[model samples]
Target: MSQGDERGYGGNEPAGHTDDAYSTLGGTRQTRTRLPRGGDEGDGYGRRPARNSRSLIMVVGVVVLLIAAIAFANQGGGGDTSGNGAEKATDAAGAGPTAATGTKPVQGRNGTIASGFAHDEQGAQSAAANYAVALGSAEMFDKTQRDGILDAVIAPASVEKFRTTLDKAYSIGFFRNVGLNDDGTAPAGFTFVSRTTPIGTKTTRASADQTTVEVWCSGLIGLAGEGSTKPVTDGWFTITMELQWVDGDWKALTHSQKDGPAPVGGDNRASSADEIAGAVNGFGGFTYAR
Candidate 1:
């Protein structure tokens, strides 16, 4: 009889029943009567039930519990929602464990910016991708461009601080150290390009309005020239940013980066200095979005 194997109640004893009494889950109780004990065989209550039957009951109960949990979560019980009526249902459907899984990139409200990030791991990844684009742009190298970006993307209170530090960072001396000419310019017949292209992004941790995002990126930097000591070169690095939902968009509270998780370059011949210079001068960068 084994007390009718109360494991059917998720190994939990029913309320009001002692620890050894019975089993129940949620607000429901298992209704099966105790199996007969192994004695007084002439009476119907004196024989043990089959072990196979007990196993079947436990399996069925567990399956039902699993289905109910999934249903509750799907009905918006255990997850967050945007509360905006216009796109709440659409966003909720795009959510679940893989909110960012769709084929097309999510678009922001006014067009071209990033949106559709949800309240989960996928949302954090989307935010990271967009942030990477913002942080790695050529705009970060120019004072006017940098200020506009900071004002538009950073939290207002932190904007001034970011601008002050970044102004100092993009100074002429800093540019020279990274192989640029003294005036943050390239040498004759050369073009200087410092750019970070993202490979992928992810969240190491997340919560409602805060998250830590890590982006793996490959960058092109250094000065390009013929008979030059420093030629345009490529490197891979990972940038990690601590982000917070500010105003209506995600913004970085702090950002730090480190060098490769890089792989070796291929054996293909390197482009000539003139070729590299022409390509860089002819091409314009994109206003990247995730």
Candidate 2:
């Protein structure tokens, strides 16, 4: 089997299911093929090269135009108004990758969530991405852990409101629909999965005391076990977090999510239920950084 055929595992939300669970807060699953037998074939890479070829050509064309523009700007002969702008642009264009900024990714943690980000753009982005992961994890299904997450990630003043709101969101019906018990525990002999992985982050606004960041993410959510009606599945989404710099750290003022800047699915084969469960148990999540 190809690598793509063995990659993702997921199932759709059950009928009549409410979108109160954190995983369904701002995104909906799109139909995707289960693990297939061959690689690259399902990913539009093996036999369908014409469309991708055209895309590649377009990308190359854009790059050539950008290079030409930069070169023309560098000529510095005529039509150069406000030489300072051109000089700045030239410096930016010429600048190459540099050494690390020397900032520690996280100074501490609020429970399992990373905290104490530096008061800067990179730090804010990092904080937002990490917080998104925490909020989207299986831990949020449990009351105690969920409260801890809220307290750890939310601003102190907003903690109570956020807690109350989430409490109502993860209802009993929501748990049952995902193959979990009312208390959010999987049935005997089964493993429930909910995990979010951030692909990247972008800062839309930043200031001394507040910053807004959007985290593009992909996630796995559902149940993995024998005879499970809902299997673990994948989704793509973007979460927008408004953060406030407080007490030498960043905390969430508010957050909202939207459906993805998702990529085309690959042709990986789907793993078995046991394989999905084992991998989830074996691998640990990460503390994201920008």
Going through the candidates in the order shown, the clash numbers are 0, 13
Q: TM-scores across all candidates?
A: 0.57, 0.68
Error of 2 at 153 (Å): 0.2
C-alpha RMSD (angstroms) for model 1: 25.9
Q: Write the per-residue lDDT of candidate 2 for residues 1-290, one digit (tens) a residue.
A: 22222212223232322322211222232111122223334334333221232222222222122212222222222121232222211132332232245678788887788988988778888899899898788898799998898888887766776765566555665465455676778777777787889887777756667777788898887667765556666767777777777788988877665566767767677788899999999999999875
Q: What local lDDT score does residue 47 receive in model 2, on the 0 to 100 scale?
A: 31
Which numbered prediction scores highest in TM-score against the true structure? 2
| Model 2 TM-score relative to the real fold | 0.68
Q: Highest lDDT, which number?
A: 2
Tens digits of per-residue lDDT, candidate 1, 75-107, equal: 211122232222111132332342336534444
lDDT of each: 0.49, 0.61
Local error of candidate 1 at residue 44 (angstroms): 82
Q: What would you estimate as the lDDT of candidate 1?
A: 0.49
Error of model 2, residue 155, in angstroms: 0.8
